[model samples]
Target: MGASHKKPSQDDSNLEIYSLICLDPSFHNNEETVKAQQQLRVSINYLKIFENCYQCEEYIRSVSSYNRFILIINDELARQIVPRIEQLRQVYSIYIHCLDKITNQQWAKQYLKIKCLSDQLDMLVTRIQSDHRINDLFPVVIYNTNELNFHFLYSHLLFDCLLRMNSNNKNKFISLCKNEYKNNENELNIIHEFEENYSANQSLSWYTRKSFIYRILNKALLTQNIDLLFTLRFFIQDIYQQIEQKKCLYPIRVYHSHLMTYEEIQLIENSLGQFISINSFLSACLDRGLALFHLYEPNDLQRVLFEIDADLQLNDMNHFGYIKLVNYCEETEQIFFMLGSIFRIENICLNDDEIWIIQMKLCTENDCQLKSIFNILRNEYHYGQDSNLLSFGEFLIKQGYLNEAEKYYLRLID
Candidate 1:
């Protein structure tokens, strides 16, 4: 399996533009406001004119890149529309033209005053033309009171930005975040510094801090930054506690899917020791059984199997984990271990055909007793006049067990 080494680019055809216009009805009589509104309408009309330029072009949609033109008539409308604009800023390079600033002035890289619509329109066109770099314009973060919980909104915005960045930039951003969080034991202090540094002087509420921490933790895991992940785990023990309490399997899934090195896996296991339940740990081990078997020594794999078996009692069977373990053992050619794992699974959990297939293999390889196989068929499986019984009889003949083959054929005939 080869990984694709794709680098991020700022292609103009891939970029999108969104223009948000919020007109304050309270300033209806003001000449400046009326002029601003008129200028905005004209600007939007000029931008729309490019839509037809791409009709005959192969990339028709790519030509204009203008996505949406939203108009807000009042403060209440602005309040409702600004948060949506903030959300859109993650993907589009939004040029907001409002009678008054709907959000922080520094939200976007460029803020054009709409005194003269013609002048503003020319500036917008010139700015976009000069700087065709998507990285320079994208992920515009805006602060709004619509979502009163600043921490939640900021965290999501930051995470979204981090995801969009290239690997090098993403690592740099994570490093910056880590530096800010250093020596800050207080959660509230960390939140304050994060908000102040990144979110334009906004502060996070106590209740929303946990959500922010969890978002960062998720990003760290996604990027496979074990160091950052461990650092975050130290600060947010409650987040891990919540995952353990809810028995959420997503973190384990993420670990298995992303973390490749044995050292990284060991770090996570040690950090989460005692916090992770035995069942959850066993399930994770089973999920990563093939990887573990390939990466670790035989002793380590045996130790993992022992731990799993110790957690599982004889009467406790029919679990999804057992099924996965048995499959892994079979694929690795550990026949006896596969048989032992199969024994832990309840008979009811398996179909008669499947049971017969496993028994036939065991009988041929280990010379398992005919009486034991018949007991399982008669008592456990209740195998009578079935197609599987006939198949098993033929299989026995192929294995040179003539006497056992004859017994099965006679039973089927009777």
Candidate 2:
């Protein structure tokens, strides 16, 4: 409410009114006041120009205090004035220090005005049947609120309507939005709208005409909808070929994630399973390394060890562990663990110095002579002979001889 008139002075009561503003809803917080002030401070100069013409300095001063305004004016002036104010407010902001007087009353007025305008705009276009009304207004309002230049608003609004409409009614809204695009220089918001609506129940095919499925695919993981992620993968299979040929990171992340589900894996794998390299598998293995512990038996562990060794010895043409672990004795640890697995030795012991020779010598397969040496190492007599007992203890653990490994590991400490 306007400050109640105390009638303290006749001169003060005679103040001129530039425009009368009324707020439909009031704000009740300080944060909204700060936001309104930030938005308005940038436009104060332009607003000052209007204020001067109407001699509304007192009203302007009040608005300037906390930077909120709900000035009412003739509807014709409003048609031009409201949009300019709204537009300027969208992009303009000043430092907080300049608007230190921000308060609840000012914010309440601004917030109510914004809600009123947004609601009015929403209601006005709900019934518009053609693209003509939206052609001049939409994109401006949708992406940039500057100057209320709603040149693109109609397209976005129509797209929203199209997405919500039944299959039969969808054509009408799409046609309206399309007509605006075709007649003007604007790209149909088809691509933009599809992205907006794709995550909804709306299908991915609806946006394919604009080639934005890649971006949609990129964001599909965020949807938490495995169904949608699968749908996106299926839709982009061909594009993924080109994307893979180019080695694009975005598509790769989407395609490689476990989030896609087994069904999704089959979809992608069926298309390019052979081309999905071991490097890619290993990359995923590195990420999914915990899968190693999930296996229920020795055979599963043996199978994994065999595959890892085969990959290292054959395809890798170099030791995998040498690169993976620093100061690693590739031949010794590698051969010993592999041999331990094969022989069921259940343990391999080595001191720090002996650990290196064991790792190196184990690299190449030698027969029962090395086997006898391994057996001697496993005997209880040599368990604490050197610091390498822990190394063998770890190998025992790796070989699934956990009890024996713990005995050795705890020996020096105990």
Candidate 3:
């Protein structure tokens, strides 16, 4: 708990950062506690450790109002700090871990934000992991980008610009990874292996390995963490390139199963005739029956299956693939659609088994009326035919991403 604080980078000032903060008397000294904190850091980007309760309180109060914070405190400090931080608007969820659950539960049960007051370290980790997933995996729908239509012009242009830029700085990216995983031995070794052995050819292999790269990349994309995204652009470009190279040559149908809240369910149901743009890489399977294995009924969330249709014959960036490296098991036939994939909602209905089945077609400019919309986006965003990297900073600047533009130019100067 010495100096593990992360000051938000200026480029990510607009982004909503998620942090896991642990306030323990001596968590770092214990081997098991170190491992648990390592696990939390593996998935979460920012983690702060503090042995002093007073200092943590000051830090929490200093954090921005827009960011999300999850806290873990021992029963000893829970009583001291719970009443103070419980009412703060930035506290998302709190977990009280202690040896005496019976005594702690008596008081923690009344707190609205205390998710769990458990004696089991494993149970405490499970609840935190589940809650973290709910926050990180919340899909970024294109609906909020515009009320007039769902052409997803903003996302399309964003990805278009990032992928086309040069990503040759491997040392810088690897150094960043090393700092983030310094506490975890396993991740540190993987980072070393990557530094010595990585190549452009093994892009997909590395991404599919569930390594630190995969965890941080997806989290950065979900949060629109511009600084982290810039640090990760080298691998991002390589992975997407390999996916593009391995694009299937014929029509393919892939499936993805996900949990959605009632509000998200209604948003898709009512958006049947319109288009919805998904912000991240979609991990889908070629076999519908195989995809069903990921679904389960939960009282709090609805199970939904995505039947995605892609016609690779159309010739566009809307490519999906079955990369051997990304395919964990040959039987799964796992396929993935690239980032910023746009799809028109063809249909949505509940099956007899109570699973919400959705039908969507991967769209290219030629297959639909998106040609006009695409041109409108280019004109509206100042992305003309002559646009190049010279305009990227200007683009970010015009879009109110001044700090991101600053970082982009600084990197260019580097």
Candidate 4:
């Protein structure tokens, strides 16, 4: 080796450090507190000092980003900070160093690492730096508080974790959910009963209740928990009522991606029909057309297609929706609507090859007029190749059009 060089410590070089010092107003004369404050400022890149607990809270709300927090506070200040433990837990890795003994040691244990004045500040800094896997850590509410409802938080965390999991892991998670629900059926029933009773007596408006349920609905949508979504359809109706009252089209837009039953799709369409203008309603309906196509019976599918065609004609809008419908019909071998849709959209929204193939196939199968097929081939496609002419002649012969077949062969020979 030419020369020897020393690498910097990962803890010192890599980690972003933040410290919060809540100074006791009564401890201005205290030597140890002053020394700890000095040590914190020297060690951390960002250090915030507050004279009292109130200022500390104000700073907590104002300060936007931080990786770790070192709180140096007195007993009374720590008590004031307890209410904010849930919020602080969400964003920061917290370590508390109280100058005096904390009265509520149990609460402190649940939320923070209580340290003595004599303990080295380096240890706290070192601990934060060593844990490089903070981003990988899932959101978990470690402490139980009666005031703060964590049910939604727990569900949100589970949904996020489930989303990141592979298919096998997701199946395992679903199995786990089923097993847990079976085991806790009685508890679940009791909780449901309590919620119903509570809702009946509560001063909360229906809108407020709807807002709460909407959060759960979003979680269900993200997880693709169709059973959970079905159970929540009652709440969705409540949201729909609010949307109707306000004549707002935004909420109806959320249903676009949802995999719903035919009845549910019809219900949404009917509800939207009342408030929206004809053109807007028709345009919005297109969003759920595919979902309806998947779920509807043959009779219902025909009804839906008729309604769509009527709306497209009434509004004088182009039949772009029919493009997907035509492709789906082709895949399913339901050619009844294919020719109609292709003919309706004069300049069909398909590639040249696709259009040619569909046109040729439909003409051969349906015994279409020879002049119309010849017009498309000569005027539209200008297909002059011998192979294409021969193929068309063979297709005409197969369709019992001997004169048309002879004409194609004569044109190719010329």
Candidate 5:
């Protein structure tokens, strides 16, 4: 105990290895393509800054007044610094330009070795920002690719990491999330790996990791984590059905996670501050909040209403306060609650009989409790421009409503 030694901060620590990335000379001429290259640089720089903090480097400047000159590598310098850039097999991405294929594999391997590390994706953005030579990070041409191979590699590595994390290290991983994920950044990373692992193990946990993953995936397939993306599709649906079957403690948790996706959320951010989810649309209508999209059946509507009510009464999510302010005690409550329960379904199960039966319940019934059933029925019936209208009408006839059922069939013929 002669001397107490303090560890270096994240900024001052030397990088053991640098994963150098460069653009193909053929892409240099195209302005948009060149822009994407520079953007990638900025994103990389951002990651370097992040590493400084996470690694606890000693050289990082004070927060109040700090120069952004740390690890500033220019693209022109990148060209001169790189010894070689090779075109590898197409399995990795659009083009592989680096010192060695092994380096690329090493970079790919790191994501799988840790949790939420992929979400530190600000590197691509930051690199683009710092590299004045390039203008765009994500170009329009790359958007058209049917399957993004790079994203697939990234996701596969992450899934491998999630699969590989030891049971004893669960607490360590959760602690990492609590430390790193302070903002909206890395939210998707938490969803992709942390949430999946936690849910599978029931030992690790985070507040909105499940919902965050669903929202991010609904956006563009940017994260490039293919294994996680495919796994989440089924994982989300399974959780939703679980809540329905078990009447879980957190139903909105399941429903929100089910409906929202990264692609959809990204679109909403670009177009408007609103997002579209099968569940959000149904939940909004059933709660009589804001109708974002169409509701397929009564059950869909009921699920949203139930979750909203439960979320409110439990004092968990009263952001909209649908339970407090809205007078669900009125006639609208019946319509909202009943229709919500009826419309819950996936695309495959949205059969003609189910639609017709639900619609008939809304149309023919002249209950004293409800006044404007016709408006709801007409609006919901016209929602799906499908060929199943006739079949649904036939279902109504079988249920003993001849006159009321004729309108749907006659409209189909017309």
Candidate 6:
């Protein structure tokens, strides 16, 4: 590794790819535009304000495909420009914020991508923030056991590497988080508190703070966005270390309820008696009633109640733990599992309430199949070690994320 603790160069700063595009001509020099960004919880620098459809369209076209734009435009300009950019994937969502909503609704109905048409900016901003966060809450990756997928194996090995790694990147994490939430006063205040009060022991508490940090970090895991994930690795390690220190001394059971896609439900059903891994941190409660209480009536999604029987007494099975100290909710008994904890699907069925209950048993080094493949990856790719952060770079290269891997190594190089 290049310079052991040298500050990351400026070349690595702008990893946040969200572009908030404001296309209202009235917003060119208006103080109200700043208020809208604050309400939307978007930073000022990330919000690109434009005065005309021409300039807005040019900027939309200029933004790299890696960045997504949440467009807030007046209906008149939206009508003029929506047709040109409606099909583009970079335009994540579009909202028409004009007085004549009744008139705009007629034409806006034709476009499938327009998210909302509102005369009220506050309501529109709330809607925008809700949609943005709701989008981030879901979208986790799962391994399918019926196929020869290697993601679960990679997850085990890579997170193992993250366990023993250390970095002087807490300042980098704080800076990046502040940049992401700059003009959003509530989260900015939280970031300040986090920077001032943060410690390794407080990682779980911060992770549970129902704010930008946890959501953005989870989103990074979902998309494998290495830049953000790597920046936040120090926090990840802290949580893991905390879990290890407080691990359950014996066998225990926990439950978690979430909305899962029908496909994911079926994947679990089809893979019963085999193994699967979720690619993010897992939190579950000891109270089954608490788990059932949170389940929603299914619409487009399936209600999944995960019943985990974790036997930490097994060799090398201290991957999850009971933590009431900083367990977000004081009322419930919470067990926090580190990222990518593998589980054998014991059974899957619908209960009398019609909710899918997936019964899973924690797998450990004692599991022959898991241990064998884990060793193969560790020895074959030189990434089985938990001794250093450099193995993560090697794992990235093995996964074919060349650009992400290169950037990771550049930060590691002395």
What TM-scores do the predictions have? 0.19, 0.17, 0.77, 0.24, 0.20, 0.74
Instruction: Tell me the deviation in Å of residue 285 in model 2.
Output: 25
- What C-alpha lDDT, on a 0 to 100 scale, does residue 146 get in candidate 5? 19
List the pairs of residues colliding in candidate 6.
1-414, 2-413, 2-414, 3-414
In model 2, the Cα lDDT at residue 264 comes to: 26
As a TM-score, model 2 comes out at 0.17
What is candidate 6's lDDT per residue for 158-267, written digit by digit as tens?
56655555655589878877776666678787778888878989888777765567766765665555566667888898888889898888888899887765656766
* Candidate achieving the largest TM-score: 3
Report the poorest 10 consecutive residues by lDDT, candidate 6. 1-10
C-alpha lDDT of candidate 6 relative to the true structure: 0.69
True-structure RMSD for candidate 6: 6.3
Please, what are the lDDT tens digits per residue for candidate 2 over residues 177-268?
34423422223444346434543222212322223232233222211122223233323332222222322121111001111112322322
Name the runs in model 1 displaced over 4 angstroms. 1-93, 98-212, 235-238, 245-414
lDDT of 3 at 231: 75
- For each candidate, C-alpha RMSD in Å? 26.4, 30.0, 5.8, 27.3, 23.2, 6.3
Error of model 1, residue 65, in angstroms: 18
RMSD of 3: 5.8
Q: What overall lDDT goes with each candidate model?
A: 0.28, 0.25, 0.70, 0.32, 0.26, 0.69
Off by over 4 Å in 2: 1-101, 104-188, 192-215, 247-414
Model 6 residue runs over 4 Å out of place are: 1-29, 42-116, 129-139, 145-154, 167-169, 225-227, 260-274, 295-302, 315-318, 325-332, 346-356, 381-410
Residue 37 of model 1: what lDDT?
43
Pick the winner on TM-score between candidates 1 and 6.
6
User: Lowest-lDDT window of 10 residues in candidate 4?
Assistant: 356-365
Candidate achieving higher lDDT, 1 or 3? 3
